[model samples]
Target: MTAAGLPMEIRSEGLPTRVRIHEVGARDGLQNERTVVPTEVKAEFIHRLAAAGLPTVEATSFVHPKWVPQLADAEQLFPLLGDLDPQRLPVLVPNERGLDRALALGARRIAVFGSATESFAKANLNRTVDEALAMFAPVITRAKDAGVEVRGYLSMCFGDPWEGPVPVAQTVRVCRALLDLGCDELSLGDTIGVATPGHVQTLLAALNEAGVPTSRIGVHFHDTYGQALANTFAALQHGITTIDASAGGLGGCPYAKSATGNLATEDLVWMLHGLGIETGVDLDRLTATSVWMAEALGRPSPSRTLRALSHKE
Candidate 1:
């Protein structure tokens, strides 16, 4: 049975009975690595994630090789991933050119990212926040015309690297812009992993008040200070039903030096299952996938829960 088939009576108070997990280990998780992961290895990692029952996985980014050489194999990787179940894979497209490349390679889904903080926008995309939003408009329109599903990302929603704390107002404004641009869904990112439960509550409240439905907002938290799970719970209380996580805590923010890895998929699934939240993911299978990915990366799995469970076994 899928996770949605599970009994829902055990869910936490105020928590959504079901949640969607957008796995990003193959793309966001690997983008910052110094060593280039071979295209075959990347494809194999994605296959393992699919076997773990992830409904959506960000397969790779279609950015310029000059900016992120780790994903320079995108053109090669996409074709290699042709064997994957097309219903689950989405590629990141940084601009119209990137989207065009993805389309040429037969990509059906794409993600465009902007930032709530001006400095982060400038540093990451070489444009101001508004400029980045403006840049995405044409891309979003063209993609819609092509019948491609588009997901928007608002990075540094909680805090910025150059600037200190980000205002809730700023995040809401960026979110409104992305929605107005016709993005199907928006992932609000805690780029630096500096958010607390209070910050999550405040931001969600502001977004809610601004007329953004919780169903359209997805939370992407980093576990830099071990606050990811807490923030995620807080988001759930505010009616968020979708989350973005990396396998084995595999990713970190490139713009924030102090930021650690993303929320571990094993840990998140463990918590969600305990809460009886349906995620359509098998915890045991996901834990095994995390272990395999860690071995492939030549690093210990960053999930404490997975490590402890493995030790017990």
Candidate 2:
């Protein structure tokens, strides 16, 4: 057994084998910022992330400009992306209208988000949990018909700013709804970063009991309470391999008060590497990218490991 008391036999072939790092800094990370990141800068950020060997990067969101003005340049930005390796770029779509916009731009991969918390759903999308699911059903069907791979997000899975502790059954219900709607993968988001290892264990166990396979689930965490990495380890213990992270520790829910950023790509990679989990990421290069982006954003990285490593230099 490993240090966490999980089976050692589940370890991958090589030490720290590659895991898919979903770069969400451009989309999830920047969306919450008060300042508008210039289109050119956003494009350059994506280029730099790709150069750092990140395979899948969420480039931008296609929400209504009134809702998220930061990504209002979605149309202009989409074309500017200019021949990105098609496999590397996935964009976020909020509803059928957003999906239509993405499909018109020839986007083959897309993501849709819903919330496990009723309050979060109403606050973020102005809809209830069931209403949000109903809204996305047609969008998911359209995307599948158009041959697009769809990823579903369950936000506020751990806790919500308004609702406090969220029940695991509610989260699983959302997950099953998305899966039924044909989402290729479902990412559980700890929107307020209130998740603990114990919570992660309970949720994953519940999902497993509900027959949701580990392969179809992904974990998206925030560092608001500094429990992201610990929670990540817990998810890994439950056989969850896919993880969502952002460069320079960028991103938090705009609807979540006093929320911090997503689990930093650098920190998550460091822990996964130490645990001999193959995330197929280059830690040194990832850190360099984080440093560059942090400089561009004019803020110090929130990644503990990145901050420490840079200090060592």
The TM-score leader among the candidates is 1
Clash counts for all predictions: 0, 11
Report how far off residue 81 is in candidate 2 (Å): 2.1
Please write out the lDDT profile of model 2 over residues 170-230, one tens digit for every residue. 8888898889989999999998899999999899988888888888988999998889988
lDDT of 1 at 110: 90
Q: Spell out the clash pairs found in candidate 1.
A: none
Model 1 residue 66 CA deviation in Å: 1.4
User: What are the Cα lDDT values of the candidates?
Assistant: 0.88, 0.85
Model 2: how far is 83 from its true place, Å? 2.7
To one decimal, what is the Cα RMSD in angstroms of model 1 from the true structure? Answer: 3.0
Candidate 1 per-residue lDDT over residues 1-313, each given as its tens digit: 2343322335667788988999999999999888889899999889888888899989999999998899999999888878876557889898989999999999988999899989888888999999999899999999999999889998899888788899889899999989999999999999889999999999988888998888889999999888999999999999999999998888886666777899988888878987888888887778788888788788898898779667866
Model 2, global lDDT: 0.85
Model 1: residue 248 alpha-carbon error in angstroms: 0.4
How does model 1 score by TM-score? 0.95
